[model samples]
Each structure stands twice: as structure tokens, then as C-alpha cells.
Target chain A: MKKEKLNIKAALTLATTALLGCHNLAQAEPTEKDSWEFDAAFLFYSEVDRVSAGEAIFNAKKTFEDEDVLNLKLTIDALTGASANGAVAQPTVQTFTRPSGNGQYQVEPGETPLDDTFHDTRVQLNGQWTQPVSSNLTASSGVHISKEYDYLSLGLNGNLAVDFDRKNSTFLLGFSYFQDTFTPEGGIPNPLISMLIGDRNAPTWDDDFAKTRLGSEDDKTTADILLGFTQVINRRMLMQFNYSYSTVDGYLNDPFKIVSIVDINGVTQDNIYESRPDSRVKQSLYAQSMYHFDNVVLDVSYRYMWDDWEIESHTIDSRFRIPMGDSLGKESYLQPHFRFYQQSAADFYRPFLLEENALPTFVSADYRIGEMAAFTVGLKYGMLVNDGNELAFRLEYYHQTPTDAGFEEPGVLNDVELYPTIDAVIVQVTYSF
Target chain B: MKTKFKLTLLVPLIVSATGCASLGVEPWERDLLAKDEMSLNASPVDSALDDHIYFSKEASSGGKSFGGGGCGCN
Candidate 1:
């Protein structure tokens, strides 16, 4: 057998010791009595002098004797800080018009331009229902709605799981749909238009700003499908595999993002709003494995993804949990986590546009889709309280570094840092009773 | 390129065709697997929170969860 095949077979042997503890309604049985469970969490995420966010989430579930369960979730979050505007570094300070047209933001020499007015609050509400269809089959459906200051989204999803081989293996199929709307501040800018309008003393939409308006709002829709299985390979191991495909249509561009137009001398001439294809299709494969040893547990997962935009990515995540022994009391443990991610730049991705070249139909300067690699290191501590209650604290650090595209840098561009590294810290606390 | 992409999709089929009869334990021997720590989702809330953070920071998302929770952070 080939090495890949051998590895798959070996992993299969380590599959679903977790079948007995399955909790996703795929293996739930009718409850003998009505019962309720609740969980809540708080999270804080901070990017070095960039953005900071705080979120609160609550989830509750109700189990009924009729072989059905109802689950509800609520999430509220607020974010504040500066965000990149897709402009490249320059040898001298630069001043650019903000999205509202009536204001301006300045960037220091050799620094990426950022819009300092980025801030928003969002709320999401969700409901889910699951029912056992037969002795070995379960079905579930859910709906969710989210609202932000400038964006709104509504979605629905359904899933079905069936078991076979004396409950040792299960197959799952699911589908989801989402409809979203964008109502950006000061309306949406026309794609590829020079968004720079010089400094204006008046606080009103000037003629230059009016000429750049495309519309007041735009709409987007997405359809996604997933197929996968979970298998119990042995008493000590569990494994899962999944394949997903999705198609998205309509308004895929960021209204606030722009690309710098530069001359051969590497001097920025103007900043123009970016454009992107209206439709996209993507496919991905994922695998996960969990194993329990004499005293520790190991969990690992990997994902491979590709898209019509020519972007491809690979991600690996792993965690090892070790008990704290009698020193920390019962049910106390420390878990260490490591994650690595890498992605190729989109087909039309460019750090900046060249004034001597023709404009492409689709183009963007967003670094998120650019060639990059990111990694995370984290640790978590969990302790049992009052026998049935639990408390957990987790701290993590994330860093991402973008690479230069294979483009010729001219004049002053050679010395500038076209790709800046992004760094962030994450902290979370959770409780269950 | 398309053919190469299709190869990754064969992983599930290969896994499903492997030996199964002796893979798992009997129903009565599920004591260890039945523990709370062995649950498929040991911590649902933590998983969700991690997903949220990664989704907001990365360009690629979606494997174990649904799609279409759009945000305006861009």
C-alpha cells in the first residue's frame, strides 16, 4: 500500500471511541425526563494597536421526553480600532480621504495606511431543533439572524445523520443557505474609481465623492453542502472525515478597500476603490482524530481547501491534554494547543496597481487573501467545581506574516515593507453548571 | 489541475472501504468511551468561540460548521 493509504488505514484503526459520548444529536436517545443545560462564555481579542474586540455568548438546551431537543444561542460583540485601507507604504507621509468623503486619515512615512474609524457592534440570535427519526437516524434544522451597523445576514441549515455497523459508524449530510445585505456608510463606491478627492474643508459629500457612488446597498447569497462520516476505530480512538462545497454570488467586494496606483518611480499617484468577481465556488476536505492514552488525550485535525479564485490553503491543529494530578484536585487539567496555516494569494490579488498597465476586470489589495502563513500557540486550564460544575480559562497568541508577490519593485519601493506581519492575542473564559 | 483537485475527495471512500468488523469494541465495553471527556465535542462553547476568532481573522473558513454569517469588519 502507498504511504498515504497506510496512514489512512492506521488512522482508521484509531477511530470513534467517542461514539459512546457523541453529543451532536447524531447519537442522542430519548430522555427519560425533561432536563435543561446552559453554558456561557466571554472572549477578548486584541490586535497590536490595530483592533480590539469583546464578545459575550450564551447557549441553552432543553431536552424533552418526546425524543426531541431545542437549542438556542445568543451572541453580542463590539469591535473598535483601525483597519487597513489597502494602501501601500510610502517614503513620505500620506493623506487620504475617508469613506465618508468629509474626513481624512493620515499615515506616517513607510507605514501602511489605516482607517481609524472602524468600529461596530453586532448581535446574533439562533435557534435549532433536533429529533430522532428512528433507532439509528437523527435529523436537525436551524435558523440564525445577525445584525451589524452596516451588515445584516439571515441563514438556515439542515442536517441528517445515520448510523450503521452496530452503531460503530455514522454518516452525515447537511446543507446551509445565507442571504446577506451590505449598507455601508456613505454608500458603496464605484469599483476601480479613484476614491481620492484631496482635502476638503466642507463636511458634505462633494462632487468628487458623488461621482464615486455606485449604489446605496448591495446583496449577497451563499449555498453550502457537506458530507462526512465518523467512525469508531477502537476503544481508545475516534476519527472523522468531511467534504464540503459552497457557491457564493453577488456583491463580494469590500466597499472600504482600495488599491494604490503607482508610477514606475514607485510614487503613489492615486488610490482607487478595488473590485472583485461577483461569484465564487469553493471545495474543501477535513479530517480529525482523537486518542486517549493511559492518562492523557491527544486531538488533531487537518483541512485542505481550494476555490475558483485560485486560492488554496492547508491548516493543521493539534492539542494535548494532561491531568494536573491530585495537586489541582479532581477534573483539573492543562491543555496545550498549536495550529499552523498557510494560503496562496488570490488570482487577482495585487499589492498595488501599476499606472502603466491596463486595469484588470477584477483586482484587490487585501492582504487577508494574499500569500501568507500564520501560527498560533495557546494554553488552557480547566477545573471542576461542585462536582457537576466546571470552569475554564484559555490564553492564546496568534501571528501572521505576509510575503511579497512576484512583482518588480521600482525606485523607493525596494526599501519599503510591502508586507507587514499581523499579531494578535486571544483570551477566553467559560463556565457550565 | 481539476484532476489533481479531485484526488483529495477520495479520502473518505478509501477510509470507508477499510476493514470494519474488528475495528470497534462491543456495546457493553464502552465504559471508557462513555465518559464526558470522550464526548465528540468536549467543549461546545470553546469550539464555537475558536471558530469565531479564526473566521474573523482568516480568509478560509468552514469544515465542521455551516456558512453565511457575514460581517462588515473589512
Candidate 2:
């Protein structure tokens, strides 16, 4: 009787073990093969009579069996052409100091003053790794380094995301830091110094102006944080909202930019090195929504941004994609995009300083900090091939308009267009497998 | 700036709160949202390119991603 009872107990234990094993098998996820995705694109951007840039980029991503991911990206930017110099146009020829603050260049009458020494090539490399910590959590980290002729940036970023509410909602936290160094072709210039073409009171060209060698290098550091939330509104819709804050300290000024000092008669008195506040804090709130239907999809986003320099901006971007051939047994789609952006001028922005008044501690003529608006319209075509490979081509047009910031020009300068409209075209292509 | 921040905060709250009315979705119903085209950033490479272009041309930059990686163009 004792042996029979023991045998029965062992059988019951075996049955329970089998049932548990089956449950584990049912919960196991299907294994997938490691996959690779690649993307390559080239872009050409031009402004009417200002800077133009051509850039090429390549990216590759590898996904592992455990759902971890690795990404690599490389970029090459080639920039050339002339850039606007803060000096206004005059009835006669105007001579200005070169970007190097060493030599001089001449701009003819009825012409927009520009500096032709704007040429440089930049290369950047980035890598990222993402790992799943649990079924509902993920962590990712990335590092990047970029180099130009006179600038270098090294940065690191990390992110963590957690999902809740049965995977219907997710929360993300991210942080990034960067250290950048700048060493211009010539030494850094002292702020607010006279850069006259041929002033008898100034030092000779060969003497290497005393005010032009303040330092050989300057550095800046940036830190940022982002808090984001994403929720699935329904079976075909989802939305994401994020708020980010960033701070930058040290050497915020552009080494090559300058502001002109004009006399009452519109005569160029001097060109001084541009100066800006050494520290800046910026914040932005962004929201995006994506909706899907049987044959089409829509994406929309908006951003509201503000900075310590009293610069505020608004952005709206939208895209619509329609599957043209999905119902006909073909894999192709068309997408149209629209984007609008507007920004307020910085408090310290100045087109040019008046020689009659005392110089302010900080001033800059960079057009980017001025009141402006831009719009872009674009279209794209995408096709999916066998083996999950894809190709896409896109084209876009951009237009920019600048508003007046209460500038008081003298003489013929009053008639000159202080802010000229800029028109540009962009073409892009991408391939991924 | 603080007022702007408060306004920004309120808009998303109202949006998300209204979204809560239809928040719940079964796992099987996610087939449509699973498509690559439905992703918030469908083409990351293109997005990065556009971001760089805008950052170089505009004064204010950070919105979708962290602000780092300084450039000399600005």
C-alpha cells in the first residue's frame, strides 16, 4: 500500500510540471532573425544670395534576436558661397574686413554686402545602443563627435522609457551633454573693436591688430533634459507630448560674425566683433499626433519654444501619406508635407550700431536671431520591394520673409532692402533594408 | 516665459484628457498602428537632416530632441 501511494504522488508531481512547462511555452515570444537597415541621403540647400550647403548622410541599424538595437550614422557637410555681412548697402563701394579680421574685401554699389570667405566642410559620426530591460521598459545611450575646420563637438545622450496601462501609455526621460571647442583661422577678436579699412589711427595690416588676438580658443558646454509621454488614443491613433529644457554656458558668440558702425552720412566707420550673452537657457514644448486609416495616414506636430534672450518661436509641421498601390497588389505610397515657422527677434539683435551713440555691451547682427518666418512645402514617393527593402525620394521648396526691427538707415541705405526674402530648394532620397 | 510655459502645459493636458475618453485599445487592434508609416518619426534620417538644416538657419532649435552638439554655422 505504501509503494502504491508513493507512485501516485510522483505521477501527480510530473503532471503539474508538464502543465507549468506548457504555460511557459505559451508565453515565449517568437524568435526572429537579426535584421539590418540602411539609409542614405543627399541634400542641397541654397539661399538667394547667401550661404548654400550640400550635405550627404548614411545610417545603418542592426537589430538583434533579443530586440536590442544598434545604430550608426555618418554625415558630411560641404558649405560654400557668400554670407551676409551686417553692413548695409551704400551708393558707393564699401570696403570691409575679412572674416579672419586680417584682410579686407570690397562690395560694389547697389549690391548687398557679403563676405566671400564662407567655406568649410564638416564631418560627424554618431552611434547608439538600445537594450530592453524588461517587457515594458527600455534604455538607450548614444555618443557623437563632429569636426569642422575650426570647431569640434563631443556629446553623449541617454534615455529611459517605461510602459504602463497595458502598453497603452509610455513615459520617457532623457538627458544629453556636450562639450564644444572653437578655434577660428585667426585668433579670437576682442569684442567691440574698430575694424576700419584704412584708418590712420589703427595699426597697419601687417602689424596684426592688437585687439584681434584676445584668445586662441574658446569652449562651451550644454546640458539638456526631456520629459515625454505617449499614449495610444485608439486602434489607429497615437499622440506624444514632450517638454525639454536646455542650458548653454560660455562662449556663445560666433567668432566670425561682426556688426558694422555707420555714421550719420551712411559712411562705414568700423566693423566690430559680434558679442552675445555668455549663457543662455531655452525651453520648448512639443506635441505630435499620428492617425492611420485603411489607405492613408496623417502626422501633425507643433512646437512652442522660448529662450532667455527673449526669443520665442512657433512651429507647425504636418504630413499626409496615401497608399496608391497597396490595394492593387503593389507597395508604394505618396506623402505631402507642410511646415511653418516664425520667431521673434532677440533683444540684443542689431543690424548695425550708430557711431553717435555709446556702444552697448552686447550686440549681434546674425539674421537668425531677427524676426522672421519661413514656410516649406514638400512631396515624397516611397516604394517597398521584396525582402522588406524600401526606397523613397522627396523634394521641397522653402521660402523665408523677414520683418523690420526698427532700423534707422541714413541716405540711400533707407531704400535698400534690409531683409531680403530667401528662396531655396531641397531634394532628398533614402533607402533602407 | 512662465506664462507661456503654463499655456503650453495646459494645451497638452486638455488634449490628453480628452484623449482619455477612448484611451483603451486591445492588443489585436494595434495592427494599423504597427505600420512603419504610422510611426511618429517614419524616416529618422530625413528628420535628422531637416533638423540640422533648420538649426543652422533658425535661432531657436530644441523641440523634438535634446539640445547639444554645437555647430559653428549659427
Best by TM-score: 1
Candidate that scores best on DockQ: 2
Writing each residue's lDDT as its tens digit, candidate 1 over A1-433 gives 3466444423322232133243533433323344456677899999997988998888776676776887878889999998888988899999988887768878999998889888899999888999999989999999989999999999999999999887888999999998899998889999999885665865554776888998889988989999989988888888889999989899989898999989998899988899999998888899988888888888889999899999999999888888896567567999999999999999999999889999999999999888999999999988876544567889999999888769778777887889889899999998764
Tell me which residue pairs clash in candidate 2: none
Residue-level lDDT of model 2, residues A1-433, one tens digit each, is 6466444434533453364353333323323435445677888888777778988998866566788887878999989989877666667788877756567788988676888889999999999999999999999999989999999999999999999888999999999999999898776777777664665345475465644667888989999999999989888899999999999998888776778788887666778888899999999999999998777899999999999999999999999998888652348888999999999999999888888999999999878898899999999888875444577888999998877777778766686667877788888877664
DockQ of 1: 0.44
Tens digit per residue, CA lDDT, model 1, B1-74: 88767777766556667755367778986776776676667777878777877777777888866545556553
- The whole-model lDDT of each prediction reads 0.83, 0.82
Error of 2 at A394 (Å): 1.2
lDDT, model 2, position A217: 86
**What is the alpha-carbon RMSD of candidate 1 to the true structure?**
10.4
Candidate 2 backbone clash number: 0
